[model samples]
Target: MLTLLILISVGLASAHHSGEHFEGEKVFRVSIQDEKQVHLMHVLANQVEVDFWKPDSVSQIRPESKTDFRVKAHQVDEVEHFLEEKGLTHEVLIHDLNKLVTNQFDSLIRSSGHSYEKYNSWEKIEAWTGQIAAENPKLVSRSVIGTTFEGRSLYLLKVGKAGSNKPAIFIDCGFHAREWISPAFCQWFVREAVRTYGTEIQITNILDKLDFYVLPVFNIDGYVYSWTKSRMWRKTRSTISGTSCVGTDPNRNFDAGWCEIGASSSPCAETYCGPTVESEKETKALVNFIRKNLNSIKAYVTIHSYSQLLLFPYSKNYALTKDHVELNNLAKAMVKELEALYNTKYTYGPGATTIYPAAGGSDDWAYDQGIKYSFTFELRDTGRYGFLLPESQIRPTCEETVLAIKYLSNYVLEHLY
Candidate 1:
């Protein structure tokens, strides 16, 4: 505990810690045609250290599907040999992850202040929340939802024309540390709301009727850790008592079928569900807020990246949600809205069936709490870039995402009966 606290303080106090860069890593996309191939892929993941990009875990790798994962440079040869031995068809989506990280910036000119097209650091984003709120007090105001385990304040921006007793939509981004594009979209959404409140008819109407509770970065400690320590870090920065690993997956730290499947009980796994439900302060903060505002919050929208999916609940199992038909229709419309821009197609359905079954997801929790319009937006790129989505694509990706989100927001407004 002492060591973790000291490290957290050091992480907070320092302007920069020497980056633990991702060098010589390759993202491989593998296609599975049968259960044998799926089992082989699972075996491969267990045998070597790899980061699951598409399905999230070995258990979720279904037959007749393509999955993307990253392997360290040292382990690439072994992975290649094993894939050959197993006769698994695969392609290298990213030749080198470090190169992708370096090239993430569209322009070498370097981003100044806070721009919509570039990924901002935690410091910059934290500052932007306060600045944006102060600048637009009428349409946007900021509040601290709770403090993270590392003692950093979690900022929640209430974006709408100031009002009371109005139905609200809770939108959160950057649930996973490595998914940089998630936070980018949240910032972009807020920017668009403020920019278009008066001129954009949809934005004007939605703001007049509903409020948006925007959480820019839910896992602040993990985000900072991703920037400073490991570029692939994907959990809260809090350390488990007896383990050397430092962080729990905040997305899996909620109480929705917690750690049942598609999540890990081990402290070291990527989808570690923490010691218990809401164990991480970040998770607790989000849960408490949502529970308190469950009445006024009519919809819950969580933003994530690299899959281009819009999914509804029941991630813990194959059981269809009771509101399946209505949610499915809304999802279909939203994806069509997404594709309207740049022809970027999106697949939408139940989270368990559409992608993979992940228990303890915030979306599932929200839906179970009676927020019928719960949706998880997995934004942009099927897998060409994986989590290293470039800065150049941010504008188009977020621009199109705005369409789908606006569509959902409006649907929630009309259907709030």
Candidate 2:
């Protein structure tokens, strides 16, 4: 009787664990051959719980572009049949999403120490911020920019030699919650900066002339939610009146273009623009800080994932910026430098023409504020892993990206007149 009771308890634990994740969900990559097909797919998505993995929103879908979406176990057959009936060309990218989700956690063993081979939880990262700043007093300092919706302190690391009235570059990562690799790169960058400070000539020069404002994780509440509740969570953790949804896409909550294109007003949408511009505390905090230092801040760089592209301003529209020629040339040079490390190719251009028109992006808004060097990086493998970028690739991704950032920073420092 004792053995039977123990066996029953073990069985119940296994069942409960399985129910916690996305069991049996499949990810499909569909090709949009024309505008009509894109509309049809959008209509179908409205009927079921479809999660768009790429292009992010239905409005960004275009002809000759590929779209990735996930369907739950119950809706798999219906979604597949509906696509087939519409003559949409589609294939399964991930057979079992839960398996990948399980594998994501398997790579990390934090008992040994903080390892770059795994995604660190919020608690670990918070502790790391304090530890790193304490270790490098002269070169790095930590301060709270603001508090997230859930009251978590948003920490920003100011890295440079102690000086006054120096030009600076502001970099932020982890805008979307599930993009774990985004924050990983930011942490890796801080490590690299401290590790190679005086030894690396280019890094030393950049640090000497310009301060680096690094926000390790921008969407703190959403990032915490992604870890504790949903792995696919992608917005802020603010509550809205008259709606059951819990968050807004902080990326789409900025003031540039103000939800004119490639954003949704629906509260339940993954790309939901909040009730008003800068509605999220996270967005407002960053905006306020940047505005306060507008004269000294020369550039802004926001990091994202999955698409291997470097983008500039005007993501809200096709109109070119006043400094388009210089921006394009600099981005071209930076991407060229980035490819040298791992032979990794990256496309570069204005955000709208380069990929899709995404309004209210922080990058575009920063450019409108007169930061000519504002840019956004979409990092890593195009679509194979998507948001669940494996831990194995973390080191290489950060190492190669460092080259591009340095190249751009050097250019910006030299051009500051």
Candidate 3:
């Protein structure tokens, strides 16, 4: 039995090592000098296996914008030569991605137990949700909303004082599997809510007036795949019929402007929109829950990373939302509060104009469902580390983000009428 256990351990280690195919891969920060260069880059992306680290997809790239993309080691020379041929100026943001991946987990070994300063795996986070809820019965509670494609329980924590039919703000993280920091912030937010229930004035006031529905990780299957199979995996883990692609982009599986823009129809594409609207089980579950509680949920906040943007509705088109003035002012105020801590700046505006026209996003869908204060937060270090943000920065990132969320929650509370 001991020998069998040793063999299993070796096999697991080998599997993990095999997944680190990004060794020596370089992330290039390319500056789009003109509109033509954006088109050229899109063409280049089609001809190669380059992964867009910022702006998400090639369609979002624009003139005068700085785009970050990752290219495998073998294609580095070819990509560099192609960029030179196109006369585009670019610099290497990450010289070796594997080195950063290695450094990201170095602090984990020094800790005696689970530490919020370091990124925790899905299993750790799953266990944490129950433990936190059990420990703080009055201010927190946990419930499984649904199950993932891989059969993992999707846990949602309710953080607030026990009350009847209180207005609530819905916040979710880890929509993309590889965005470890996203889930980290969700966990930190819950911890902050529970830890500061009575001690902190803003948080206490917000909790007294509102309930926070926090989904720590949305893409459970893909999140697990990222931990065990590939560190850079995005999308869900459900297999589509007639194709080998494993997952759909949950953010693009919503009903609002489904698959219309900034999304891909190809199953193999990173931004694959899925076979149909709400095709993925995870998205369907979220939609059902939100639709069931549409009356009480006033705001919808979905968190993402590596862009440092706070965006509002109308992501499917350039048309302004009816609540444009109110949403914009709220975003600006929240961003100002975020910036006050550590001087970290955040860009705030409508999703379509502020970033790109991404169809089927949760915030846009929620707004369409009459949840007026819908917002999406792209957190931390525009593109310095991209999805591989170091563990050292998690605390500060969550801290500043908490301030922004508090500002928004307080605003939502005042205007809950």
Candidate 4:
């Protein structure tokens, strides 16, 4: 299967064309010491073409938080000058966005096809869905849950032994296009599932009784655009009517809060919730699948990256869920297991309090739909690397993540009543 994954990489190289170059663009991190600092950055964002790399929006930036953003080469001087003038403490995290992006490739030759260590193109990942299922017939099978606006298949892989009426966990990744590490972890997970099914006792038992529905890439069109046009692109690649703006943030496209807060109404905004709930085909597809499988899906895991956070429900607001204690305990246990592997620290709690309030998020939607174990994983490197985590670290990131996910799954299995 690994060999087939490598072979799949060879043919899809041309699908990704030379994208927008980030040559002198730099990523900056600002230390927000007070509401004054937060307000200052928020005001600056509106004045400049600043892109928030971490918080997703200026509204989410809070006092005492460190925000990461990318400023274009032409605007860096002005942005820095403004920061200095305002007395906001800040530093360059990525000196050269282009160099960091280039280093992320880790190889110029591109000999291999689909690799767990390397970020794979959508074309390669799409093909691997079919190939990996064929290679491991007993443990894996692929089906199309839906298609993107661009008509790419929304490949869903069911990973586990065939069973009569088993409960399952729904796991998805790549909701935002430029978060390449998100999809990388999904592929690594499926690979580990089939590779260690019988040899690894924990995975063995988990697969014996529970099925895992894995969507390797949820935002297909935008992921392709990120590879072929813009490396920092985030959102679905659907064209909104009456505007030239391209896409909606799928994370904010769910029905949980339906863009009530921590989301944008403007079509061009990064966190645009779409015209309405489940408006995007990808959002509809996932909603329909989970709805159809609601009876058996005991847990929901939506993977994302660069924050190393394990978050639970109520992302739409600050109110705690009824299962707050139970969920918090589980999250704490999961973090413990994850950190044990590499000593990679992970903070865990309710989403709104832990990070920022993000309405229409899939985890919140899933939890509201009765999947009590719904969780979101923001994986790896707090922001030393951000979305462009090096290929060399993929293995450890995935390895540690698997520990947390497996722990969560075990908890679900034990509590499924």
Candidate 5:
């Protein structure tokens, strides 16, 4: 069954060609500090793209006013003007529809000689994982931690040498669904892990001494929706029970300072925090798994895309953590290592200070759980491509990311007590 999915995905990807068109709709990326503000702002706008920074539906505000709002901006300058005039108080960037390109590294990988037999649907990724585990049983094992709202299996891959007690690193991707680069990075991480295990000293050392838990796709239902119905779906597909609104931002549903400053309470708002903390099954599953493994999990690393940032925790506000200095230093070192490969610049800083205040994020949750080395990597295109990053950049982005991860992992291994 998984094999069939891969074949279908490969065929679809290979048949894909560029120059296809969207509505040429004007899109503006807006940031609102409060959850209510996100709701009110979205309610007032004409046509807005929340960019998965916020949740959808399932909010703290009344559902009656939740709606499709659009910012008045057809061009970048106009967007700037709108931002200046509105005093919106959140970061708003206006962009046109000319940026999405399909010719990227993942696309190339799908169309390349890697066997259409191996490149199928989202299910097939698990099949590939199974095959890898079967062959390298000592270093790879598959675990079904929980199930998604849609009942899809949440598969986790624990990769490392055969051992009982070892410091571990936790990595997850595709929490936002639209950030396709996240899953691509997870796949790339697996590929690199397999290829460089015995070759690279640092990688080999880390793998031999520590375990890596990789969750390739966190929001499976939403990810499938992005591939099929809407390429921009940002939350899970679970219905909000009484309302017609669907999905909640899983990232915003965590219990860590949830729905306070950076999240929303309106069901129609993009950053909707959900009915309550850990309302989404997927979020609960991840939270429980991390909590169970909190002691040995030395670091938590999540991959997101199109921001070109290496951000550390405390995203809910601007308050600095005790390890801020060490985290910042490591981010700088990782950026230096990443830049050596592709010359792509990555802004490294505390999350709230670097981007905006985002409450209840997985990184912050992990940090609160005592995992100090928690980081989120937002990869590629400061705005050149947005969420529709072309496939051509996958290899370079993943390659540089691998360097950064390896550097960080080595640092963890050396300092581990």
Candidate 6:
């Protein structure tokens, strides 16, 4: 009985990670013969079977039928053409799969070698935030907006000079959980802010005028799980109420497009949206905090990895915003600044045209919530070093990113207040 109980518990735990288990080589589609079966797929040279993030009531996917997906035969370009010609709305291929995986491995090795004096673990991110706040009492302060699913404190480190309430810039990282570089960049930004305040008049001036509130790692439970088990793990670890699947992609869990268009309703998927909107505690905390600070926040930026593209809102659909032109120009300028620093290039454009149509993304949410300068940065090498970006590239990546942020910051300063 004891052994059987243990087995059941383990099976239940594994269900969250188990979606419609597909070997990386197989291309299969979930068909909704009677209903629309739309799920988000991250296109590469090949379409690997990653579970789509689904909402609560309809989390379990009872696939009406299976369709073979010949990803390799149809190259990413071919796939894009196919989707276009078919008038099918979905995430078409952008980068090749081999290059993406290879670059990810390379990045991991490279990052492992770099030595950042003040780097901290998932558990220590807040402690480090506290230390930095204490050290720079006048310019920095920390707030615990709320706790993550597993009760880890979600901290917002606000950086700026003492005085009047300034127009704020909100930046969040580690939203996908496995993108260590995102969180790393957040820490690096804070460190640089502390080091350059007095010397770099430009940075100092911006800090004096604007406040930067950064959430280093938004998905703490998933991040901790990635560190412990799977390096490629995405989404949170909150268990769904029925049918055993756990975790919802916090990114997809946002209420903006909830589970429409680019998201799936399968509990076993990678981009699984939890039981409901703001289902994940972390996302709820973020939403609550953002609602409170909405009036002050002028620009909102969320950092992610691999594609080296700077994208703007309407990720849920292709509809252009009123400020599309200005956003595009700003993105172009930011990428130019990034390239000027390290000769590294980045594509910049609207989210749907730039990459894929993603629903419920924080950037789109921020934009919808009236933050005009909402942007999402897909950082680092386009493919030579995807998610597994190395320690060695950390400095260069952070440096280039800093340049882009500075560019945007300068632009925000001129526009906001």
User: How many clashes show up per model?
Assistant: 0, 0, 0, 1, 33, 21
lDDT of 1 by residue, 131-152 (tens): 9999998999899989999999
Scored by CA lDDT, what does every candidate get?
Answer: 0.87, 0.88, 0.88, 0.90, 0.74, 0.72
Q: Write the per-residue lDDT of candidate 6 for residues 296-325, one digit (tens) a residue.
A: 999999998867889998888889999999
Candidate 1 Cα misplacement greater than 4 A, ranges: 1-19, 108-110
Cα lDDT of model 5 by residue, 334-398, tens digit: 99999999899999999877766778889999999999899999998775566767666677788
Clashing pairs in 3: none
Model 3 C-alpha lDDT per residue in residues 181-255, reported as the tens digit of each score: 999999999989888888988888889889999999999999888888888899999996798877898989999
TM-score for every candidate vs. truth?
Answer: 0.94, 0.94, 0.94, 0.95, 0.81, 0.76
The best candidate by TM-score is: 4
**Candidate 2 per-residue C-alpha lDDT over 305-360 given as tens digits, one digit per residue, 9 for 90 to 100:** 98899999889999999999999999999999999999999999999999999898
Off by over 4 Å in 6: 1-120
Pairs that collide in candidate 4 are 9-113
Clashing residue pairs, backbone N/CA/C < 3 A, model 1: none
Q: Which runs in model 5 stand beyond 4 Å of their true positions?
A: 1-21, 28-120
Query: Where is model 3 poorest over a 10-residue stretch in terms of lDDT?
Result: 105-114
Model 4, span 82-119: residue lDDT tens = 99999999999989887677667553334557877788
Global CA lDDT computed for model 6: 0.72
User: Who is ahead in lDDT, 3 or 4?
Assistant: 4
Candidate 2 — which residues are off by over 4 angstroms? 1-19, 106-113
